[model samples]
Target: MMTAVAQDRLGGPDVLYLTRRERPAPGFGEVLVRVRAASVNPIDAKTRESGAFLGDPPFVLGWDVSGVVEATGPGVRLFRPGDEVYGMPLFPDEAGAYAEYVVAPARHLAPKPAGLTHVEAAALPLAALTARQALVDAARVRPGDRVLVHGAAGGVGHLAVQLAKALGAHVIGTARSAQHPALRDLGADELLDFTEVDVHGAVRDADVVLDTLGGPDAFRALDTLKDGGTLVSLPSPEDDGVIPTAAARGIRAGFMLVQPDPVGLHHLTELVDAGEVRPVVAAGFRLEEVALAHRFAEAGGVLGKTVLTVD
Candidate 1:
């Protein structure tokens, strides 16, 4: 048996509670991870509150996981029992990472960066992968390219600023003035206080814009991009006319959903090990304090990621 956070019905953070269930075992090409830590993300809270993506009750929230491999099923060769590993497995599905144990497909995970602790590693997967996919895969950011990241101090945005800089792009970030020093230290070439300045006028000719804030903010980001620039919107599934508007402006605009990618995880590991990228942990909570963690994450104004430790 294993202790996991489960909700009988979706409502709010109050719905999350600890319970015991049969310990899961790995199937073919899978690994059973003894979860040491998990991170709370906006998606987790959104899913818990409105069933976003996970359209039902009675589910465990969390995809980011950092731990040791407890067992491996047949055909699994990438990792052995006792190996430290981390990944966002079965994203948009139930990997049940907010538990004592989780079973994940072998290809969905990679070696945990040796330089990072379990808590820091746990903070990387979903948020880092989202930033990596958006900047590297979707935007195809190149050296010398002008990249702008919205919500620069937030989870994915903070990572995006670093990743874009690592990719050789001239990174710009949007956040309140208080976060400017941190964002600049993260390699942002320029910082915009979104509260005080009009983003569209303050910055223009961006080669790529990573929009963590959806809706009108996303539409405004289009104006900041150059004629052939790309805008990758992370939130809001409804197109809501931004696609056609972008087309008319000769810009590329679309939404991107993060997926399980072992390759991306490996790349992140390389960056972390090389000292080029690091996850900023805003707070830590015990596994049983998941409700509090959810509340903290939903409250916003976090500098980086919130983590849940399982001991």
Candidate 2:
């Protein structure tokens, strides 16, 4: 049996409780991982609050997983028992990563980059996937392109800043004044103090803008894009009222609900090995402190990633 941080109800972090269940074994094409670390993302908090994605009571949370393969199921060739691996497991609904062991698809994972510790690798999957998908796949960042990211110092924002720069895009980011220097060091060519500067006023005609802060800002982002430039947000604020404005401006706007991408994970592993993109963790907690971590995540506005050591 192994202990897991679980929640039996849909509510605040206080709902989280510890439970011990039989350690699961891998099925065909899967591997059982002895989890060493897990990173907490905004999705986890929202899911806990709404229970929108989680099943009934007594569900496991957490998406990011970094661990060693303790057992491999039949036909699993990518990794052997005892090999280190990291990946974001099937997220949104079930991942069970905030536990000592989890079973995951072999293809969904890759060799944990030797360059990063388990905590660091654990921090990469969910946020890094969001950044990678938005900056590379959705935004189509190119050499000499200009990119703007909202919430520059936050989990996904910081990674987006660095990933855009790595793609040769000139990146600008918006954050509080206190975080400006940290954003710059993370490869933001320019940092706009959102506390003082108007986002639409200061940024104009970018190739792409990643609006990590969704809601009313969604409508504001449309004005910053040049003709045909894109505004990708986590939520579509004006669903009832946004399309006509985009039609009037000729600027396309849409939301990207990030999904798992194995190829992208493999690529990020390379970036980790090359020292181009490093995981930035603000702090870490043990699995037992998950309730406290969720309370903190619910309070919002943390710099970098917050992680949980599961082992």
Which candidate's lDDT is highest?
Answer: 1
Which residue pairs in model 1 clash with each other?
A: none
Error (Å) of candidate 1 at residue 105 is 0.2
Give the alpha carbon lDDT tens digit for every residue of 1-311 in model 1: 99999998989899999999999989999999999999999989889988888889888889999999999999999999999999999999888899999999999999999989999999999999999999999999999999999999999999999999999999999999998888899999999888899987889899999999898888888889999889999987626788888888788899999999989999999999988899999999999999889888888776899999999
lDDT of 2 by residue, 146-226 (tens): 898998888888888889888999998988888887778878998898878898888888989898877778778877778
Model 2 scores worst on lDDT over the 10 consecutive residues at 235-244
* Segments in model 1 whose C-alpha atoms lie over 4 Å from true places: none
